[model samples]
Target: MASVLRRKAADRGKSLLDMILKERKFARSIVVLVFKATRLRLSRTSHKPGSVVLISAKICIKSNSFTRLVEAEAMVYVSRSTSIPVPRVYSAFEYKQRVYIVMERIHGQPLSVDWVQRSSTSKAKILEQLRLVADEMRKIEVPEDAGVSDICGGPIYDPRLPGRSHWGPFPSISAFHRQLRNGIVPDDIRDPESIPQDLRELFLFHQQLWGKPVFTHGDLSSLNILAKGDEVVGILDWETAAWMPCYWEYTAARDANPQNLFWREEVDKFLTPNPQAWEAEAIRKKYFGDL
Candidate 1:
């Protein structure tokens, strides 16, 4: 009976949210009002600029230019397919060119909050749990012919990239690499002598590194990981999650912000290290500056 009542309540909430979404002006007004009135803002770091306001004790809404509806979709996909703990999305939509995601407001604090003070054993336990999360995400089956893309096979967004814009759902890893090289196909360069020595080396290195597509949480900073008593209760910020090359997860985690220096050093403890991929990424970034 309790389960049935909960389902009915959820359905009613969805219906009301849909009605509000239909009225764009009213929805925008409500978002602004709630954002200003709310005492708590869930988004803690400037690592990703966005506003996540707690509308109620149990619910929150994330709205920003950087947020995308696909982030909500990615959370839904992960929640259904894996044991990884993610926020439960209620509704996601775009209004006035800005995206808003309404979701469950997890009560835990970010892992970075007390990380420096935690004992070695507690830290080890948390890292072990993260390893399990990494394993579970890898077990998700990729569709045949799947390329690097957002959860729904749409273009992906990564702020750390050169333009901080949405890029292709490339047909293959090689095609993706070609895009990275600004459409200069390595094979098309018949005269390697014409290219700079470093550029030539990078192209050749990328060509030899072929990796299978796997589900990736592209931003795995400690700030995005929520913990309750050393147990990771939720992994927030799914905007950068996607189907990416096998090396992506490791490199992304390792290449975290400067503030996350300690976490960056500890990433390999939970995630499988791909030293070659890290070197390749460093080479690419050396030539093509990131945001």
Candidate 2:
């Protein structure tokens, strides 16, 4: 596997592992191991939570190309473009239809865990910091030459659509909304008609509003946020991030399952008022019936 990875890296120009390992002074400590998953696996030999280096691997079917590459690039892009903190990517390489990324391992508790103990003031401060991060995300501008309204849309490169590639890069918000009901119906909501048409209509109305492309963290769930005390030390996971419509980030955050009442209320405090939750629920009903 090492020889295969090395050859594959050479084909891409240079060995990212070779270069990055040297730079990090890893020397010979690096080990490649696997975990079980349909599409991805975590490296078992990961650094301790606060370690300066960590590695991850994703081995997918050949058609998947290199989604891990997209993830690494997104992290690097966020680190360079925003005040938001993300693990620094040391290297990313594709070999034998597998993708690997070496990066910093942030040491912090999941915000979901920390939020339970946080005082109101600390929670408020964290939300404020997130608001600033959101603002910074809005400042990211993709070149017009990219020729797509949704830069991270479709099968070209989005971690969200793993099994398929030709999905979107929608030309308009309405176009994206039209495809929202693609989810598989959950057992509880198997009846499509149970989802109110009024809700669907309301969602579409909001879709007609103006939406400009901006960088967005595709998943802003509490688990993805790493916090120490009152401060956010890291925002983990960037595979779904893309230059999406301005509302995408807030919408995703807003729509995330609220694990408790405090989180339910805090969410409202952090983002611009949008009807994303309604739309997302409506879509969920349509596809995965009430899931």
TM values, all candidates: 0.82, 0.66
Q: What range of 10 consecutive residues in model 1 has the weakest lDDT sum?
A: 36-45
Error of 2 at 85 (Å): 0.8
Each candidate's number of clashing pairs is: 0, 8
Task: Give the best candidate by lDDT.
Answer: 1
Candidate 2 residue 242 Cα shift, in angstroms, is: 1.4
lDDT, candidates in the order shown: 0.78, 0.57
Q: What digit string (tens of lDDT, one per residue) describes model 1 on residues 1-291?
A: 655544443334444444554453335544444553342222344433347865555667888778899999999999999989999887777777877787889989887778899999999999999999999999998888788888789998888778757888888888888788778765787886787776776787778756668989899999899999988999999999888888888988888787787898889999998787787777788777653
Candidate whose TM-score is highest: 1
TM-score of 1: 0.82
Which parts of model 2 are misplaced by more than 4 Å? Answer: 1-67, 145-166, 181-209, 257-262, 276-284, 287-291
Residue 129's C-alpha lDDT in candidate 2? 86
Q: lDDT score, residue 86, model 2? A: 86
